[model samples]
Every structure is written in C-alpha cells, then in structure tokens.
Target chain A: AQTVTQSQPEMSVQEAETVTLSCTYDTSESDYYLFWYKQPPSRQMILVIRQEAYKQQNATENRFSVNFQKAAKSFSLKISDSQLGDAAMYFCAYIGNSGYALNFGKGTSLLVTP
Target chain B: EAGVAQSPRYKIIEKRQSVAFWCNPISGHATLYWYQQILGQGPKLLIQFQNNGVVDDSQLPKDRFSAERLKGVDSTLKIQPAKLEDSAVYLCASSPLPVPVYEQYFGPGTRLTVT
Candidate 1:
C-alpha cells in the first residue's frame, strides 16, 4: 500500500509572494508518479503539476513547480508570484506503476491575500 | 475540448435513502474514475474503470455503494441506505488508456448531504 502525507493543514501567502506546500509519501514500488491537484470553491479538481519518479529533473508548470526528493520520499509544490485565484485546497497524490488509481493526502488549504 | 461532466451538482437526502449520480467523461477517454472527497480531505478513489470493465474497486464499500461505466463512456454511481458518513463530494474523472501516464481530467463534483 502507498500513502501520501501533507503535514500542513493551512497555508497563506501575500499576492505576488511565493509559498510552498509540503508533501511526503511512502511507497515500496521502484516506479511511481506524484501529482498536485487544486480544488477551489468551485469544487473542481484541477491538475496543478505532475512528476514521474524516473525523471531526475523536477517538473514545473508555469508558476507552479515541484521539489521532488525521491530519496526522502518528498514532493513539495512551490507557487511563484501567487495570485488570489491560487487560493484553494491543494492535494498531494501518488500512484504506483499501474497508474490506475491515486492515493491522496488530506490536503492543505491555501489562502492568497492582497 | 469538453471536460468531464457530472449532473446534480448538489443533493440532500435522508439517511437510509438511496441516491444516484451521473457522469459523462470526455469523448475517447478509456479510463474513468469515481472519487469521494469529504470536507477537509483530499479526493479518495472509490472505483476505477478501464473502458466498460472494472479495473479497480478495492476501496469501494460494496454493501451500500455501486458504480458502472456502460459503453465505456458514461458512468453512474449509487449509494443505498445512505449513512451520514456518506455525505461528501463525488467526483468523476477520466483519462486516456495505457502508458505515458496521462493526466486525469476532473468534473465538477456532485455534493451529497445525507441528513
């Protein structure tokens, strides 16, 4: 079994500032994947970013990036130049080689303030 | 392209009653998923389908929950004799089949309130 963990329950960042959300996971599989998903008040889960365990280079999507430490089983998301729209509940997820389903952490509620 | 679609954005029902939610995945998506998202928690996979076949349903509570994806396109999830703990958001997602690990596109979830 695999599990994802997000220790922080809530996070806040000023507009235009940066914020990082922490995530960790436990997996026995040598191959796997990690992801960050955002759910706003709209109740839609939007893909923020993704990373493959085989890739050594971290994955980044525009203002959203991840610091993936495979050895430490950590995959943290970094948001640069945060905007109010970035306010949402962020989730960290994992999937083994099958990639059939995702195991998600509780989530981190992020607030962006002006 | 159109995203995944789910109907009845919100639902309220008394405990022990039955309710069903509908979903239509993006055209051509071969894998469909049903997830449960409780307040203050991330979405948890309840079941998954590869085309019209059940691929994974290990976490689903079979006694009161049931789901099906017919014709490999649209899907439906149902809960019978709902419990208060069943009050949560039901999300539908879809992705292409096989390698490359395509990102799953999500639909606006249907929120269920079992009172």
Candidate 2:
C-alpha cells in the first residue's frame, strides 16, 4: 500500500512571500505520479500541480511548482508570491500505474496573511 | 468544459437512517470516483468505476456503503442505517480513460451529517 504524508498540520505565510509545503510518500512501485490539490472553503478540490516520478525536472505551473525528489520519495510544493486566495487546505496525493485511485495524505491548512 | 457535479450540497440524517448522494461527471469521462472526506482530514477513496464497471473498491465498507455508476455517467452513493461516524463530505471526481497524466477533476462535495 502507498501512503502519503504531510508533516505540517497548519502553515501561515505573509502575502507576497513564498511558502513551501513538505510531502513524503512510501511506494514500492518504480513508476508513479504525485499531485497537490487545493480545497477552498467552497469545498471544491482544485488541482495545483503534478509531477511524474520518471521526470527528473520539477513541475512548475506559474506560481505553483513542485520539488520532486524521487530517490527520497519527497515531493514538496512551493507557492511563490503567495496571495490571500492561497488560504485553503492543501493535500498531497500519490497514484501508481498499478491502481486507479489516488491515495491522499492528511491536509495542511494554509493561512495567507495580508 | 463543465466540471463534475454533485447533488444535495448538504444532507442531515439520524443514525439508523438511510441516505444517498448523487454525482454527475464531466461528459465523455470514462472513469468516476467516490471519496469520503472526514473533517480535518484528506479525502479517502471509497470506490472507483471505469465506465459503469467497478475497478477498485477495496476500501469501501461494503456492509453499509453502496455505490453505483449506471451507464458510466451518473453515479450514486448510498449509506444504509447510517452511523454517526459516517458524518463527512462525499466527493465525486472524474477522469478520462487511458490516463497517462492521471489528472482528475473534482466536484463540490456533498456534506453529510449523521446525528
């Protein structure tokens, strides 16, 4: 079984600053995918960014990027120039080619200060 | 493109009662998923369907929880004789088949409160 872990339970960052949320996972498979999702108060889960385990290069989506270290089984998300809208519950997820469902970690609540 | 849709944004029921939630996935999506999200925790997979066929439901509590994705489009999750511990948000997600990228789109969850 694959499990994702988000060590931080809550994080606060000032506006215009950057914050990095840490995530680690345990998986036996060599091929897998990692994802970060944001769930706002509206209860909608939105995709932030994703990284493929085979890719050596990190995945970047504008202000959201991931520092993926496959050897360490660590995938951290970096939000650059944080804004108030970044306040939400962020989840780290893992899915391997052997399964169709995504295994999610306990979320880390982020509070963006203005 | 329309995202996944879930009905009954909120539901309240007493223990031993029955409740059901609905979900409509994005058009042309070949896979649908149901998840249970407890308060202050991440969403846990309850079931997965590949075009009306069950793919993985190992985590589903079959004794009380049941789900169906008829016609491979709309889905429904039902809990019979609900328990207080079942209080949580039910989320629905969908993705296309041959998911090389495995990007899933989610819907606003249906919050269920079992008193």
Top of the candidates by DockQ:
2
Model 2 agreement with the true structure over B1-115: per-residue lDDT tens digits? 9889999999999999999999999999998989999998899999989999998899999999999988889999999989999999999999897343757889999999999
TM-scores for all candidates: the values are 0.97, 0.97
Query: Residue A5 in candidate 1 has what lDDT?
Result: 93
Q: List candidate 1 stretches off by more than 4 Å.
A: B98-100
- Candidate 1 per-residue lDDT, tens place, A39-102, comes to 8988678889999999999999999999999999999999999999999999999999966788
Tens digit per residue, CA lDDT, model 2, A37-109: 9999976899999888888999999999999999899999999999999999999999897777788999999
Model 2 chain A: weakest 10-residue lDDT segment is A94-103
Single out the weakest 10-residue window by summed lDDT for candidate 1 chain A: A95-104
Candidate 1: how close is chain B to the reference, as a TM-score? 0.97
